[model samples]
Target: MDVPYDLTSYVRVLKLASTPSWEEFSRVALIAGAGIVLVGLIGFVIFVLMSVVPGSTPA
Candidate 1:
C-alpha cells in the first residue's frame, strides 16, 4: 500500500530513531532487556511454584 506523509511527520520519525550517542543507547537497551528477562524469570518461577502446590492442577 502507498503511504502518505507531511514534512513535519517525516522529521519526527527521523528524530525518534536518531540516538545522540551509541554508548548511551547501548546502556539503556541492555538495562531494559535485562529488566525484562529478570521479570520473566521471576514470573516463571512463581508459576512453577504455584503449579507444584498441593491443590493445584497442571496444564
Candidate 2:
C-alpha cells in the first residue's frame, strides 16, 4: 500500500476544503435530525408490532 501517497492526497483535500456557511450547516443539520427521527419512529413501530403479534415469545 502507498501510505505516503494516500497521506499526500488527504492533505491536499484538507487544504482545499472550506468550512460550511451557517445556512449550509443549518440545512444539513435539519436534514440529519429528520433522518434520525424517522429512523427512531420506524424502530418504535416495529417494536410495538412485534410485541402485539400473537404467539410471539416475550423478551
- The top-ranked prediction according to lDDT is 2
User: Which one wins on TM-score?
Assistant: 2
lDDT of 1: 0.85
Please write out the lDDT profile of model 2 over residues 1-59, one tens digit for every residue: 99999999999999999999999999999999999999999999998988899878565
Clashing pairs in 1: none
Score candidate 2 by TM-score against the native: 0.79
Write down the TM-score for model 1.
Answer: 0.61
**Poorly placed runs, candidate 2 (over 4 Å):** 1-4
Candidate 2 worst ten-residue window by lDDT: 50-59
